[model samples]
Target: MKNFTRVLLAALLVASFAATAQDEESPALSISGSVDAYYRVNLNGTNDERTGGTIAPGTSFANKTGFALGMANLIVGLDGEKTGFVADLAFGPRGTDAVFGSTTASSSIVNQLYAYWNVSDAVTLTVGNFNTFLGYEVISPTANFNYSTSYMFSYGPFSHSGLKADMAFGDFSVMLGVFNPTDLTDFNPTGRYLGGVQLGYGGVYLNFLFDDDFFQADLTAGWDLGESFYLGVNATTASDSFYGGALYLQNSFSDDFSLGLRGEYFSDQGVGAITFEENVIDLTLSANYSIGNLTIIPEIRTDIYSADEVIEDADGIDVSGDPINPTYGSNLSSFTIAAVYAF
Candidate 1:
């Protein structure tokens, strides 16, 4: 009888342990990503690089002529009740251009890798490399309505590696972070660091980033005008660098079709050249057609500069032996068609 009682007690203890384990929520793992490709053509310049310069705009992505691969992104995530981690990886030309500051081969493919802890219902802390919160556009093609990036986004910081805290209060939210200098995503070799702050209410965000040598202030907002029409606005000014404003107007015709227009006015403050001061205006129109997880974008873009000779023309050289490749008028135009698939 004593032996049977001991055996019964051991079984009961095991059962209780199993029941507790079943009641606790298990960590969930998820995988998702996107792939993109595009074809582009110059409207006023040579399509090839035989003239010693590419005819695309000065923006970040979708600049290559003919057919090109954008990137393949893979994001893996694991979430628990109070902790989570994300590993985002990318490959191809667009990804390489985006993560240009990553020095090592292993770090080059990593777009974002971070771990977060939920300190409370309204507060969270995250550490590691993550995308900057100041921009209206992101590095991911699937997220932006336009295939090509804006000059403000191209000049702003891409990613930051640091510690940040996000807190929320009703409709208001605040984020504060200390990071390595702009685009230094792997580690901080320079002793200087960057600080950032973002304040949000409703859908509008006011962001600021500052360091010893750089300071930028940005405003981003979005609104829905009707059942099918939406508008987005972004404006930024970086000290001694660049200042620009862009407006995004989009109308959805159906569940699978939408049209978007972006208009921008940008000014360069001799960032590219010692004596160059130019103001530029860009207008882009695009159509989005969605089928399941795939989206097709057809776009047309035109840029006008304040000064002549801003863009390279098809003409090769002048009679004075000076290169006329970049000696055309103040305007440049191009067309692009892109396909993006997400899952």
Candidate 2:
């Protein structure tokens, strides 16, 4: 049934685009998507039970023939001399969250909708749904070197529905926007109305987003050392009604055929009921030899959580700390092997 719906929608979108196309001879309409297939073997047994910053059922690593429509995005893009429009839609298994209280999965909807109007050669105005410009991590799995989204990315605001403006100055570009503060929250709470700013140049980036009760700022930088090797780092600080001011850092090392390492640490400054004043560390390293269109990527990653105190209920079980044992599995780890494509 779901597969049938997806096919139907795809056809409908194409049909609408064709019917509305004025020139019929212009080559401005482009439709594209990708296929990501993989096998992920989680060492934590099938019933290990999840207790951290994730949307899986248990703590165990998950292994399967994975395919998700949400991971694949479709965009109806129309480009002209100075104006462009895009209506983005998504569908598939790897959707952001499962229905609350039920393990059943959720599908997709219109994730991004916006238009770009260039006022001058160095500036443009955009109004609609787009990715936030703060974190080094992104929600799209294929856009990332790894399949898992970072705690920082998942923890921070995902997307905002609003209007924005952008400007280019020599080697850098600056973006600022206002959003309705509402987001696609797994069909739960209505988001907060907020705004943010992003500036980027030469692989270095910085962003700031704020609302009635939350304020966050992050910085990122990346470097390529030639010889198939690269390194990147991200740092963030924020304070919210639920959690106090906190600091974090994440880093990555990548090479052609050998290894990659990732690590992140977070500390609290006094805010939420629990404060989430815990430290988490994670790592992933992989190796592969590529030939033409395919390459095999086998990787391993872990999560470690720690705190001075672990709160508990009357039963002597950790009821106050995060669901994932921030302090154990080397503290926590998952492994995978996947083949991705680029064109």
lDDT (0 to 1) per candidate: 0.84, 0.52
Clashes of each: 0, 23
lDDT score for candidate 1 against the true structure: 0.84
The Cα error of candidate 1 at residue 164, in Å, is 0.4
Q: What is the lDDT of residue 308 in candidate 1?
A: 69
lDDT of 2 by residue, 184-247 (tens): 4223244344656788898788887766666787887777766566677877777752221212
lDDT of 2: 0.52
TM-score of each: 0.88, 0.67
Candidate 1 local lDDT, residue 334: 95
Looking at candidate 1, the ten consecutive residues that score lowest on lDDT are 15-24
